[model samples]
Target chain A: MTLRLNLLIVLFLSFSALSFAQNNEIPAVDVKKIDGTTFNTGDIENDGKPIIINFWATWCSPCKRELNNIAEMYEEWVEETGVKLIALSIDDARNMGKVAPYVNGKGWEYEVYIDPNGDFKRALGVNNVPHTFLVDGNGKIVWQHNSYSEGDEYELFELVKKLSEGESID
Target chain B: MKNYSLLTSAASILLAFTLTFIGGELKAQQGIDDVLNNGEIRGNFQLEAQYYQEDSLIGAQDVPEKILSNGFLNLIYTNGSFSMGVRYESYLNALLGFPEGYRGNGVTYRFASFTQEKMSVTVGNFYEQFGNGLIFRTYEERGLGYDNMMDGVRVKFKPAPGLSLTGITGKQRLFFEYGEGIVRGLDAEFYLNDGISALANSKTQIILGASGISKYQPDQDSRYVLPENVGAVAGRVNITHGFFNVNAEYAWKANDPSADNGYIYRPGEALFVQASYSRKGFGLVLAAKRNDNMSFRSDRTEGQQNLLINYLPALTKQHTYNLLATLYPYAVQLNGEVAFQADLIYKFDKGSVLGGKYGMDVQFNVATANNIDTTMLNDERTTRQGYTSDWFKRGELYFQDINTQITKKFSKKVKGRFTYANLIYNQDVIEGKPGVPVIRANVGIADVTYKFNMRNSLRTEVQFLLTEQDQGDWATAIFEYSYAPHWFFAIMDQYNYGNEDPERQIHYYNASMGYNNGGNRITLSYGRQRAGIFCVGGVCRVVPASSGLYLSLTSSF
Candidate 1:
């Protein structure tokens, strides 16, 4: 009994050490917006612009909800703060055929790109869909969120405003 | 000596990596296809380390102590439509939790010849799942850490639209090697709605499929004449009429037995019937199943996934919510089971009384399973079909459950859900350990969320589970706070109030925080993860409860 208890304690300590070793606070990733042209990350970051990068899928319900929510407020968001939102669809070829139709049906204003092989998502370490990354004008990632609810868009806009003003906040 | 081997292998891998880099650079400088004509070499390696602790109360202990290390390396070369790959796997100090004889690594090869025109042939380790995976399925689930690779060759012929044929011959995977049996199978599927005239007249769609798998395992026991070769045949048809869909499949296996029925060889049979109705936001499904000693295997003597000939699918909703999922995981029994399940989901329109502001979603599910009745066979019978038994006797119900859930969004800032489930679980077949009482469980859960303005929100969940058998009663409470884009925090506690063991009657609590930036999100949590049933396929392994802080970081590039 004592041995089992001690083993549990050791496992706990090791896991705690692993948790501490994980760096939770790191500077945001700097990335350029995809437009079928102009693939320069440094120039995009130096322009002091806020970038909203959302990793999504065509079949994932939460991704649909997040994109629809942002679409409903995309006009207001752009007018309020000159922020650019980019939606990356990670749908493979099996489901990629639905992406164009789905986006057209929703009438989203954000730029859309395909990460069919999930190259960009892996680079960003995204494990789940509907993961959003907030990158500041300096192209450094400032904030991120996974999943979405009804009112999550409101919170997103607040961060966009703050980041556009060059404020360091969490 | 061990270090020397490691150094040699490491040097080889480094040399390969450097060569690949230099090859790519040189190709960029000069022209392409220089290395490709010589044969391109591409490889990838993966390593894993695991720590296992035993839990004795649930009969999940008895594993030998060891630090487990396993890795796999795959090297592939592709030219034109022909490709070849070799995979090597090694496990040093494999823990008792894993199967035996998985210590050494060797090369496993794959050669595939394919064309865009008519046919594709593959000779190597391959994964295939037939029709929802009933009669045959070979696949890998890395997280739960299970793989049933097929060491065989397969051919797929697609001469025309709506018709396809596949045939395979191989053996199932056994720890670091192959099972001691051979399997041969053939499957053909035909779609009635495509390239046909009779079925295309009325929006009617039909799919007909037939599959057969024969397993051969040599018998060694002198006391009983075990059928060295057993065969199972399954046929399924799916017909869709308007908005209603119906699918049915029937499978039968020749007589074969082992330790389950006292080695009384009994030819088993199973039948599955399912139907669903769906239009828009509302869907309903009903299914009934009956199975008897239908545990087809490559080797009847070895249990687990040794020589699985058929796969039985789970009939429960695969839950994702943390609190709802951790309590009980359903396990399927192949010896004998007569079961049925039903699911209904309806979504209410927005701006209604029930829908409030956004919409309301309600779901209900119920499932039940029972043992099949059997008659005593004369001890003198031998040869042919083995033991005789009744096909469909309504035996005692081994398990039953009913669940109902409701979700509604009152406004853009608030949403909530209410769920309740009543379950009856048989411990004998599920836990596999005798003397554990059957469990009658009643579970209730409520989750509510309220957003504070735009950038902040708070969500809370409370759950109560009452049971009189086994571990008794439990109650859980959870709270989460999200600060919009960047940060979120959660606190949760689960209390066992009716534990039969006094030492197990304790409260487990956890606190967690998460920060997401760009494509990376970091979550940190400290808490006690209650040991519970972890199941893949129809088999389950109980995980022991432990207090620990866990961190997981995943990235893709």
Candidate 2:
């Protein structure tokens, strides 16, 4: 048993190493538009500009706080970096009916989608809400953040600025 | 040795298949480039460990295993139209408050799937849900240690642009093993505006969905004749026009004697309806639900959130405030209940009277749940028929809450929120505590934040709960400081000041800090926890009080 376990671990490590050497792009998963139409995550794009994907839910307080703070400076961010924000709500059927109304009441201008079944969320390996991902112009995921603090949006904006300028960010 | 050999062969076969695919791609198309460039791999990991200390005062018992931990890792690989994944989970003796069945380490979940144009198929483990999840839903809630995933075959076909059909047959996962009953389901959905060209330019949009699910389990009881096959069906409709939207679903289940309903052969039914209207800056939603013996489970004897085949949505606002959320939290009455909720949100524009320099957001919500009226039948044991219920009649109130909140920016560097709630909790019913009186409470909270710079901030919260029963009245205060992109620290104390027993009046104090980097986070805390019912989406579990040191780490790539 131990030998078999060791073999499995070694095989997994090797595969991980090989995959890590290549660029990671977004996975294809189906999500729902606010209008109830199916939308594929692979088709998400912003004309070669940087794209920000934020996983949020109507019941999550930290997610609401993060989105509300970003809404205050979203226009400025777009003007400076030409970036687009995609807000994905992981609300299940119980609260899905409230998502559009909740987003509209907040007056947020970001493109919104619904992942009622959490397909896109699981595909992206998001364990919690308020998880943010920054995808570069070439559609390669560059940076990601878990959880949210008061000023985390500023750090996210900084990355967006760097990516828009074609500068490498680590 | 037999299990080891089987697993070894499976791994070897998978490795060989991958290598063969790589070789084939290299020979048929570009050399080695397609294999590396077209495939993507991603996964996540999480670990939580806690060290326990015996504190009899708070009802925390001694832990034989002084330290316990839970860990999970998920890995997925995708190439073009094909993808596969596996999850490894370990619970060293299982954590406190978690299901005991989750012991040892193993690969609990694995699946391979492929999609080509309009059809997709999954042949291993999968999660699925029908409309509103009224009749069938297989999912995982890691926080609750609840996972009822299906292990079988599923196929989805989208014959048209706006129409989708799905079929599934499987057995539910019962911890490390599979349930005895087999489940089969079929679902279909149609988007009228997109499916029919005549409605392509229509202002109103409509979506229709229907599903039917059945479970098969052999009857083995000698004293009673039990159902061998039980089936349920549900239908849903969603309509949207301009700023108005309405959605509703109704489900019916055939009679199947189970432990949840006391082995009474009663047909189950449920109805859920929601309507909303919203534009920029203002929104309103109204929802109502009715359930009658709607506790559908695959096993006749299993209980406590196991083998559940449907979800009963709690028609109430999911409160976030500490005092409002934890104290007197309501759980759905699976046996029978009627509930209603109303919510309104409006934002006063900047420069307006209530808006001032910065706009003010106001939210008001009210929700209530009551038992369904039922009359007992005379048949004691011969027929097993339970009772007849009045469809629209309301019985005793189980729970009620009215709450409101206002958020505003006081100045350039200051923002604050104020909230108040009035709650009526029927402890005897909601908590299953016999002889307990109905408790009424009032709660108020003030949360404020001060921004020092673009990268630094401080936040504080003061909350108070006034009640005359149970824990009496309580007060809590919290403070947190954050240096963005990296570090955050928080401390909190909750005092049961108004407890009738002086010796039981204790203060629960805790402090924690965390560091967050891209896709990685680690946190450590030491605290005294209070015993309470923790719930997510109406499903709940009792969390015992404990004093402990806790650590958590999570990362994704």
- Report chain A TM-scores, every model: 0.74, 0.91
- Pairs in steric clash, model 2: none
Categorize the docking of model 2: medium
Model 1, runs deviating above 4 Å: A1-170, B1-115, B259-262, B321-324, B378-392, B452-457, B481-489, B500-503, B512-524, B536-539
- In candidate 2, stretches whose alpha carbon ends up further than 4 angstroms from where it belongs are A1-20, B1-37
Docking class of 1: incorrect
Q: What would the per-residue lDDT of candidate 1 be over residues B1-557, giving only the tens digit for each residue?
A: 66344434433333343345445555321222222233333334445544444444333344354345565655444333343455566667653345555666655434443333457677777766555456777655432446676888988776667677789999887766688889899888777766477666767678788988888889898888777887888898777776566777788777776655457656677787777766556667787887777777677777765556566765654443444455665666778778788877776766777766676777788888887776555664554333455655667667787988887767777778788988787777676778777878898988888888776888888998898877789999989888766678999988887899888777778898877544345667776667675543234555566444445443321
Measured by C-alpha RMSD in angstroms, how accurate is candidate 2? 2.7
Q: In model 1 chain B, where is the ten-residue run with the lowest total lDDT?
A: B28-37
lDDT of each: 0.63, 0.87
Predicted structure with the largest TM-score when compared to the true one: 2
Error of 1 at B329 (Å): 2.7
Give the share of true interchain contacts found in each model.
Answer: 0.11, 0.62
DockQ of 1: 0.08
Number of the predicted model whose lDDT against the real structure is largest: 2
